[model samples]
Target: MADPMHDAPRASITGRALHVFAFPSLLIAACLTGFLPAAPAFAKKPPPPVLTAAAAAVPDSYSAAAAKEIFAEGGNAVDAAVAIAFTLAVTYPDAGNIGGGGFMTLYVDNKPYFLDYREVAPQGATKEMYLDDKGNVEPDASLVGYRAVGVPGTVDGMWEAQKRFGKLKWKQVLAPAIKYASDGFVVQPWLQKRHDYAARSFAGKTNFDVYFSGLKAGATFRQPELAETLKRIASDGGREFYEGRTADLISTAMYGHGLVSKQDLQRYHAVWRDPLTADWNGYQIVTAPPPSSGGVGLIQLLKMKADLKPAFDGVQLNSVPYIHLVSQMEDRVFADRQQYLGDPDSYKIPVAKLLDDSYLASRAAEVKADAAPGATGVKPGLGDTMPERAQTTHFSVVDQWGNAVSNTYTLNGPFGAGVVVDGAGFLLNDEMDDFVTKPGTTNQFGVTGDEVNTIAPGRRPLSSMAPTILLKDGNVALVIGTPGGSRIFTTIFQVMTDLFDFGMAPQDALAAMRFHHQLIPPTTIFYEPYAPITGDLADALKAKGYKLEGQPFNGDVQMVRVNGTTPEADSDPRGAGVGAVFPLSPSK
Candidate 1:
């Protein structure tokens, strides 16, 4: 048999008609018959471990390096976080920097602290300030005018946090931003998108041509002006940005462009707010409270879920009850937000009563198990709030020394106010509209504007910046936050559950599918990553009497988690982020 097979194989088709025909036919038959083990079905090789070492970082390279260096230099998480913030101001500008204002949350030695460095209204602002001749509110025009800008407080907040929780000196922490701004930094893809968004606002403005040209994709833009500003802050501290030469320039620029007055700049102040907290399986999760609705709204939603314990206990992620419960809870939270939440300073918002378990339980009873909620359905008493129609940014840092920082920043709408301070190379925040422009008028999040959020002289605008921290056994367990105006609460909520409850790694948690609902639109927005389960969820939600709209994943979340020994960091891949660990060592 072997001799016969070998002799047959030795035959070659070389010119003879029959031999050539037979050889060609045999080749064709072989191809068609598929006798060969079609590209051996082999198991896909696993991808190389991204979190190769115990220490990890989120995506942004500059930010990752910034955090790493701070930790390497003996700074704890707070110091590194502060350093990363300054570095982000230089590296990521569309978000809040010294020029803009927002909020920060700190977890230090098992305690939670919130810093409210939100912008303040001008001296002359009033409820009807944005009203036109016909008494119609002009939010766009108002936001574009100097009157739209509020007193910036981000610098003060950052410095104040450093004073209390940071280990490294302010200058040492800010040195990275100054160098990046002075030397130049690569304008990443995300920055390019933001630059383009802000570019139209800067058209025909002074220095527009000089500064924006270099912001094109792949361009290395050097912000020497910002570097100088950082230098001044480094020397004189945050006061320079508020009451010093920088303030004067900012004021002059605003005044020249029909924007805010100098009084607003001098009057800016950052407040230390009492953190709102809720218990989840014995772990204390702390977040920002009003003038931001992040804390209250999150609590309301979580409280609703607390009663539905069985949904979270299951192993498989795709359960009908689980999906329905999460969606309904989200809707209820947004509904409450639209009706009652506002600036606690002006509005008589009974936050204590709102977050009360009994109150939330009553609201949970309103969610009908079988249908989409109507606007009139599921109301949260007298002070429901809505998220502003805006975009924002976020960053998180943890140094080796037990100090951690979570911050969320924004300019309200894109290229806030479309007003730029001449020669300052910074954008002013249009945070004024964060106030309710008119009673009963709808703001970004479809919430009814009321007296509480109505504009007033020297009132800080309401925000949704919810930087959060979680403590386990009296130690920092997680530092997390996101950059999505109305969707902020949902993003953070999901990450918390994913990390603490589900025990997912930071990267896996971040990469997981996400959904957002604010109750205004009465529809759930599902991200693409949820595609696999979309049909099933749709059916499940429908069976529960809910309508849904699948949407692309829209928020960027950066998170850090501690698992016994080594800490881990994961930035959303959907964002222009880079996650890395300290010391750059291999995984354990």
Candidate 2:
């Protein structure tokens, strides 16, 4: 099944740009070979979403190109997804990773699947792992060193997805990433800000400057060590990362500074659990479940929003009343989030009771048109709670065969724990910070947690990564997800409502103004600076006792939807990413 140019095993890189190899040029200067018209930038607001047949929408163009390559070789959505995931590790190290872990939602063989590959606490982990002798939380103790890392699961997750439904050989699917890691890819100008930020924040705590110094914009960024690691994984499958040489490197790198060890790595495995699916407004909704509070929160928001104004029938998009109404739904959910959700295997998550119609109705009945109940106003009805990270990435893929995959993965922070394995060349996740390091404390994203989600040996932390798929009748309607820590499910709820209920085009919905409110700090509201609320609307919310602030950006969503059986997708314009469709057509 190899292309003629790939018939022989050979490659050569010329300087920092040109290359003479089958897969080399694909990751070079022109990475969007199958991409459509240029996606809008965050500078502009309400850019319409563009949908095309057999598409892939990702956080970076190189990753999109990798998906395109796999599709060209007759790979299914899952195969293309594997290609995208690994390619991201090479091209978008901040989020796309093999060293971290996340969740996945898939539509295969007319059914739904949810994969929980979230990282887990080490065997040595304890509830007070990040607390000091005085019972105070240690600053950056769970966010900036080897002690921050948990056992990673991305490798096993990807392998499980491929093993169950992928059509291409595992080695074949991993080739593009290996090639990119070995030959290097053109560094986009957009990465400079985040690159600079990482250097400054991690100056003394990590080896970031030593390992990532070459990430200057417009350069050929290569990771030979990472390529070698990928080669071993490709040759031996997922076990290579969990039990072979890569595991040894990770354990040695941690030595006396971290809790992860060879034993922790060997015990890691991805889980295939039933997806959370529901029917609302004639659409079948499917999303991530328990260890992740996303699906539950999403459904609750949808249910609460459904009860408001009878229907979204006359609600103007972003109108004062609309923002007020949606904020009410959001503010109530945090109480539930902080009380009744955590890893199903470690703690009992009251999923069914929390999602029961009677329960949601009771929660919905409490929503009011006035301002939020101020900080500490809401409480868990049934009781319990959890937290997680924000520097994450999401991608949506739909192959020509009606197979779709929506995935979101992260490193707990940009570049993860800031610790890159010396010989491995990948970042380790600070996912341990996702747990309740101390009761009633907030993590990097400022979401408060309780003991229900406390650290435990081998337990997966609570998460808000909501990779989701929606279906109309029996056909796929939408595949979507994003990264915003506490802002995730709320943002996803708004976008999906825009597409289905408000009739906003895909890009407009993706690029539209975004606003967020969390119960931890109930009086403050954060909206994206790009597409913001600065006029009477701001005054209106102010009149309602809300203090508004502008964040540099909002959620960067990667979304795909069906248009009468044809696939279409658009990456968030607020991000430096791309949306592409294979078999390009002039009309598109």
Candidate 3:
């Protein structure tokens, strides 16, 4: 495999300072005096190099470049995001997928909207399907083979978002992806490593042989079949992919191995829901809501930290004291997650109560200032209610219209179920593994679950994918998200603190080392290797009775900061990606 940084194009960093364009004094006065009916919409203009209006950060350099092209062609954030989503399918097969599904958060005209397109359990799914005759959980039932798949929703979700907010034609937005798939792209070291890891699982699968045969590091990999499929989708719209020949091909393959049927494909629809918002340090944080535990869990963690303020103030960042305090709070919030968060459509979640200020204050009171709390018996904070993979991709986009998008999608595990449909040219998702086979049991990521996220027909599994936006004065300030199994939320939380509390730039924030402590098995603190929390910091944390393990890598985060009107972007250095900015003029 070729090294990602060595093989991929370097990101162009723009040094432009951001400045917000002010409304004319007369227009503001007229609106205030009721002289004008309403405020006029801001007209779209080409972004100037001095004031960047569009920026994108994707896990794959090709995808980022494609998204920037869409923006340069006068598309809005939604259009650019859709282009990124499709292009990723061609370039980053590990997680970028149409056969899997996830979530999206979009900000347009000062309003935030969420789209839940996470894959759903097939109609034939049952809570006990993964259990054996003795009622013991079948280890492989939900992790591998045909039985692991769920009905996919990516196509539906992308179509719905574009239909509502896209400025370019669907066909135009899809052209770049099709071209990449047909002409091929260079494989980076990261992708080669992914292929090596997934190779064993693909053994004896004919479709895998057809698409991945002879793949090598630094070599060109083309998918003419996928290109043809994209052509059909572009010409006929999503209907061709969902209910026409593509659906027929997928149904035929799935029915032979898994439980999905033609009806499942035809019935899938993307749902639009209100985003969850919380106030933090005078800024409003907005993200995906329930069925996804990311937003609520993040808010609860932030509130807990806010309540225990002076504790963090005295302790240096990434120090033993700071790591211990944050880990303690994480345990409490995650306890709440396992106890309450779930799909609201299947069962009601107490989102309002969990985020209540009073309840958070009570939870914060439990934090110990000097010592590490024992992991054994910590329980959820007292509240009346409530309520949620590592294989995923996240991209952040901001366009010339002040519209922004944060999208995170996944295949559940690396290469998903590792099964490709006979002629579909895509892999199926093992998202069913995301659900608990039995109460108190841990899934692939070692995260436990309860009834709230049990497998049921048509139910969307709980997810850690948290596509998020930060707003200041009702305008987008930041667009961020990441891909890492159970570590997604913690990664985002750390990045937020880096930007808001420590005041680091987006690039520096993403580059900083991070740690995670999921409350389920609370004894260990997972820290990224070579991060600041090493040597003395590591020793100090261990002395506090917590096990510290160094992870080679954590989450792959991609972010965009709207410094006033200028958009600045960065992709995690750990992955093969680029943060490309589109200039106002083509000549630049």
Candidate 4:
């Protein structure tokens, strides 16, 4: 099989410039050559053709192409999203998997719905599960091995979304993924790098050799076991994986690791809830609710900036003052996240009080224009009651019928738990690491949490996966999300600012340099390696008493911007993904 990474369409400068430069160039050339038409008056040329069938942005080329194919086959946004999710399970294994779980925000018929399929702790789980006999937090207890695995919800989540709004048969949606797993697909560089890293880190612990043996960039990789597993799912629906043989296999494997039991598998269920929404600059922003700190955090950050004028005064987007302001807001929001956000099902979260205008105003009042706030000193707002990886995958889909789906799924950390089920051919999530094992102590990602997010029996771990949809005048305006652990909400927030405030197109918005500040350690700002804010900008920030630390990359956002019936999509340039706008059929 050919490597889709090589064959996928690349974003071109000329293609983007066609609408802005082509017509002007033609008229200029005609006038220069004395061939300008005398009878015909020049009028503005029509804009480029809009993609009418569907526009999809995904974390992998194969998955994006698979979604496009589903749309071509008459599937709606939900159907295309289902196929893309499954295909990512095969192609983007570091994060996408049937063994993990996530949240989805679907917009259909002008109504939005939220689905929470986040992994839950087994019934045997307890607040002290990750603590050592000496009462100290055991690092490995919740970060690796079978004990770290949570009851997965990806299959059920996708199943529910498809069953509710899909226009194609479930089997049809699973077909592409099944073929990719059985027949094999060319290994892309990103997957190959993950394979190499796993081989080194999970040496002797996992069966990396079994599935990814001889894995190399541009080489064909196949997983027949996974193929059979997908076939069973296709034939029996999601029950086979959740309640039947597959579940039994998972239970037996987990039991050997002393993590979960068959009963745990039988009791797992996905929840359907009202999406958290807020009005932002005349647009309705809808996102996943609790169990996801993303929605609330995003809203709070945006709200804080609502009353403030642009820091750079429209001169530069990534100026020192602008970056400092954004970073300050992030520190405050994350402080609130650590202290308050958690699973509303397990705790009483003050969602209403947190979003109150008065509360937000007080929080925003703490910001200083000339100086960066001390991160550790920043405190959460006093609410009546309260309320939250770098490893995850997000995809956005918009179909011809105006239906849209924004989904973000993950296995917690990359190749979570660093262990794959023996026969299941899927990696289990280490979502237990997401809990507040020891308050005040930072997790692997340098993020801290409080009692609100502590572990408990049947409690879902909090996440930073923000699957968001922007609506203007009750119509879908934007579909966007990303996979960046603590950086997810921040990344999406920056992109939104770029599009709405800076007036950038989708591609430029995603391509812009990004930075992240989690607020736990304070004093340090993690910026992308080649981020725009450097040199004089870096010096300016330093003068303001901020420490700038450069990191490899931050987030990979997949987004689609809607203009009436047309949708333009773009995948993050920081990652090796593809964005495709499927051609409209003649009948449409």
In model 2, where do residues sit more than 4 Å from their true spots?
1-53, 311-315, 370-376, 383-390, 584-588
Native RMSD of candidate 3 (Å): 9.8
- Judging by TM-score against the true structure, name the best candidate: 3
lDDT of each: 0.66, 0.80, 0.79, 0.79
Q: Model 1: what TM-score? A: 0.82
Error of 1 at 331 (Å): 2.9
Q: What are the per-residue Cα lDDT tens digits for candidate 4 across 459-530?
A: 888888899999888888999999988989999999999999889987888888888888866878888865
RMSD of 1: 22.5
Worst 10 residues of 2 by lDDT: 32-41
The sequence of per-residue lDDT tens digits that candidate 2 reaches over residues 1-588 is: 322222334433221111222334443222112111111211212222233457888998888889888877767789889999999998998888999999999886566767889999999999988889999999999988899999999998899788767877899899999999999999887776688887787888888878788888889999999999999999999889989999999999999889999999998878766577777888878889878998889988887787775634576788776777777677778888887688877666676666777777777777666545463377776643342211688999887767789999999788889999989999888899889998789998889777778899988898999999988876788889998887889889989888878879999888778898877677778888778889898998888778897776578888887888677778888888788878632311
TM-scores of the candidates in the order shown: 0.82, 0.88, 0.89, 0.88
- Candidate 3 residues 1-588, lDDT tens each? 322112233332121111112334444444222133212223344333334557888888789778867876778788889999999988888899988999999886556777888888989999999999999998767867779999988987888788766767899889999999999999877787788877777576435656676467789999877888889999999767789889998988876678999998887777765577777888888887877989888877777888899788867777778888889888887888887877776787776767877777878888887554584577866543434210789999987667889999999888888878777688788899998889899987778877888999888898888999988888888899998877888899998988888888787888888998987566689877647467777787777888877665689899988887788888888777788778763521
Error of 4 at 401 (Å): 0.7
Q: What TM-score does structure 2 among the candidates reach? A: 0.88
Per-residue lDDT of candidate 1, residues 1-588 (tens digit): 111111233232221110101123344334222121122111233123322232334436786777776666556566666777778777776664666788888765445666788877778677787899898988565455466677777788777777655656788888888888888888777778777766776576434445556776777889888888888889998778878888888878866455457666676667765567667667777788887888777666666666655545563453565565677787777656655666554566666666766766676665544545453455556444443321467777654444567888777766566555666677667787777787767675454545556777767666667888777776667778887777788778877777656877777877777766666556544544543346666676666555666554457888777765456777788787766676532211
Every candidate's CA RMSD? 22.5, 12.6, 9.8, 14.0
Give the Å error, residue 68, model 2. Answer: 1.0
Error of 4 at 89 (Å): 0.5
